[model samples]
Target: MKQDANEFSSFAETIASLGSLTKLESAMSAAIKSSRVPAKETRKMLKCMSIQEAGNTALFQFMRDLFEKVGVGQLVLIRNDIFRYDFAIDNSPVCKLYPHVKGKKTCYITAESLSQFFTKDLGLPGTAEEIACQNAGDNRCEFAVSLQPLAVYQLALDQLDKTIIGSVIDGAGPDKISESLEMSRDEIIFRMNILKRYKILDDDYQITEIGETYHKYGEGMGGDEEEFQPPWKDMAVISNAISASTSFAEAFTEAASQEPLWDVEEKDIVNLAEQAKKSKSFAELLSKQVKSDMEE
Candidate 1:
């Protein structure tokens, strides 16, 4: 049997982590920046998940529902692998919209990020290709997550190392990255040297072509799907947080405080806070996000 955790709801944590609605753009920017530079550890993290676990209709449904619950859009699972994420309210403005401008440049970042999320989080094999876009005057945004073969897994970077590489992609020096990522200078130096040894980083701490290619295509094409890890929820703490709160705002704050990893929106947090004041309403709200994660 799996251990029961005393954590807050994952949905509430996601909302709280989003920061203020006013700063959503910056958060999105940060997330985008983080995605551009891939680290070896990121690849390792991705490799931990196998294809058998990720390549299935049920996993796709979970991903689809996750997006919908987060208010990103209404998801239509067109096929086992393909999906249409209709963004009625595009929270990720980083996915540029070329509405009046006549060009077929869809939300490449969004598509790629989704690809990475599926590749890394789910260990599914596919190119998250963008087929349609609202920005292109389409009714919705469509993504063809083609089930394909991941060639191999050939990177071995650790978490801190990957963070450094990602920071470097943002054009930050090792020292600056150290400050930004809160890593010690010595640790940054060590990781940079390792990356350099692997030809992932040049002597000048720049991303080599191989490194660039790895970052660009590795997530979509490398790791083996046979070792995939399933998605999970951390509910106990958030539930306890909610249970302990005297008011909706405190509950919201407690939930938000638990997530330092991702960004969230104030409107969502406020909405969730309002719902969480009543147990029945809150559980119902959580069921929409992730049913299995919440324990009544």
Candidate 2:
């Protein structure tokens, strides 16, 4: 819709005013407010899946489904692997906002959202970089999310998982480890298989160097697992942004609408709110109404 475009355009203008690096950083950070909700919900479909099972497959599928659900655009997966995942968005909404700006990567929101989906949603830690951009003369917006093995394993492993690894590191067999942990041998074997899938254990179940490193530091260097807090708690925004009806644009609009919080008033925020409500200005809203009636 034009309203969303204008609000995003305002945000773009403000961020574009800063130094190149700061502008990119702010643009990426701004995506969290709009992106976190759908990413959180879409992840539930794969809740029972572990990083070992979901890493390259379910994780990517989750992202593909999420971008569509959030009305961002279709995510075309190019490659899937343990270290890197490459994807492209042919219709990147963020890129289309900058019709006149050129010669630079402009899909920072799409890129960062992918990073958040991996780390914050799928428990896979990584940073995503926009490698090719339509704005920079590329045919499509392309991104590569690179994962660090240690950080991925750290977040992927649970307390019992660490215990299993530590037991393996001490040369204990599954039967002995299972007895020690007061768990069924099948469960112990299952977890060990998960560790093996992570390349922390060899074919014979002996611990690898990755396993040794993980045993020492995977759980807070062998202490605790940290969790990501939602935007309301972290950003000091309204608590009810969790409502199912709240879309990404709505969230961004609300955040922008809080103009008084800033050092200076942002007239763009007011314009966005007014533009969003009027049928003549917000084609997206009109389409939503039609879809809602059809669904009803």
Candidate 3:
């Protein structure tokens, strides 16, 4: 009878030990789930390359690669500066926990996190619009990515405006410039007026000294002498060569040949060429510049 009682006591201790082990396991799992620091898997996923000096295309591509590396999902480049991130295969962070939950129209968490990453980490103000989501019963999850800010499109004169100035360098009349640039006559006059306001173009639509400077360095050349400008301003020869070459490849070669004039690496030249290739409008504009150079 005593032996049976001792055996019961041992069984009770064993049961208690099992309970303690289960509790300990549960606590450890909870601690891991609620960890503020990134896990080993997350650290491996976040091994993204630096892109502080990368242009629009490179930046977007890098982000896409980083996301995919972290098991975000496959990314498709919709346009020169836009991407569609689809998170269907392995449910994204936004939908992982709330996979079956319904009634949410947007990926609020994903959008918010991405916005913070772009603005704080990338130094770029951008937007992530979730047009389709798997949680919303869609076959796939999708978000449109744009590197440029909306304010840039709304406030600043665009590539077309600047290209118009480049096309008119040889005193081409509005009619000729319009035909060459494939722009409406009214568009030519409107952009010319804006250039005049900035004192970059005269009444004759000729490029003024300020206009020439602006053409090379953009808004950076506008400030007072004491004000800051990009370090690349000293590389005028290389910049002009790139602008003058008929093709991006040609420009890259020319820039490479004149390496002594600028410290820009060949990889940077390749990146610029790649950026130009990504945009049809930019390619056309460069062609116009090349034609203008020939005329000069």
Candidate 4:
């Protein structure tokens, strides 16, 4: 959307008023001069700018220019407060606000924000992906943004697969999958049928070799087997090196060690194991290995 120059200037002035233009500019320059810019600080400035009373079109254009100048043009800002800019660009909503209930004063976007944004702006064809945010109290509520369409789809598929498998393994009907994945019975059936067609899910909803591999490694069994290999082997090597060290007590210590083989602590080893368990493939692991070896 186009906006007048006068309106843009007004919005800019409001942004400067919220936070000292001098301070923001200094931070921006400092960040730019450094090897890497601090995105969070930059975003904080933008957030202040966005919340100022201004026309959506003018603010949107201003933000567009600001991010573009900083070499982060593709990144979209999602505002939770309505007083802030609430608009969409490139099939993505920029701002969303949730109603604050008693004792929940923190202003943040809800999971429904993603669902509505994706469904309305992006015009996603299929079912909406379920997303939830974890609060400090360990309570989960709808609040998250999908990194990408494929990522959202993969997450939904994984959830569906897990629910179906868990239910079947427990000798329950597929209804549990529908409930857990927040999909309708029809959707659950359709997804299961598709998996069956690909030989991933069986008649009883049991995970086949293909499904099991995908669950563990995050790649379709029909595709290249290389894609499904987990990075645990490389992580194991790192863990072993860390475990063998006497001076090092953590991965960071081992990584910083001058010795050829660095030592890692039991906790760090377990953390790496967990990461490997969640890794999609060995590519990330291999890349990390190469970097680690180079450092050594």
Best by lDDT: 2
Clashing residue pairs found in predicted model 3: none
Lowest-lDDT window of 10 residues in candidate 4? 92-101
Select the stronger candidate by lDDT from 2 and 4: 2
Q: Rate the local accuracy (lDDT) of all candidates.
A: 0.46, 0.58, 0.45, 0.36
Give the TM-scores of the predictions, in the order they appear: 0.31, 0.50, 0.33, 0.21
Q: Give one digit per residue, the lDDT tens place, for model 4 in 219-272.
A: 342222112222222334333332343122233333434443235444434433
- After TM-score superposition, the amount by which residue 36's alpha carbon in candidate 2 deviates from its true location, in angstroms, is 6.7
Q: In candidate 1, what are the lDDT values of residues 1-296, reduced to their tens digit?
A: 01112112344442443232213222223332222223332343233223332333453444454444332454554433121122222333323322222334335545655665555654344566677766666666676655333322243444455567677887999789888878798878877876775677998989998677766666344333243233323323323332333244444556666765346554444445444322222235456546533633
Best by TM-score: 2
Worst 10 residues of 3 by lDDT: 38-47
lDDT (tens digit, per residue) of candidate 3 on 1-296: 33322221232232232232223223222222222221222112222222221223433444454444333454554322221122223355435433234544335434544554444443335676676777777766666545553322222345566677677676677899889888899978877876675567888888898777767767432222222332223334333332333243434444444545356454434433333323223335357547756987
Query: Could you give the C-alpha RMSD of every candidate to the true structure, in order shown?
Result: 20.2, 13.3, 26.9, 23.1
Q: Kindly list the per-residue Cα lDDT of model 2 for residues 3-62, writing each as its tens digit.
A: 434433454443332222232333333434443433333233222234434434543554
Better of 1 and 3 by TM-score: 3
Candidates 1 and 4 compared by TM-score, better number: 1
Ranking by TM-score: 2, 3, 1, 4
Using TM-score as the measure, name the better of candidate 2 and candidate 3: 2
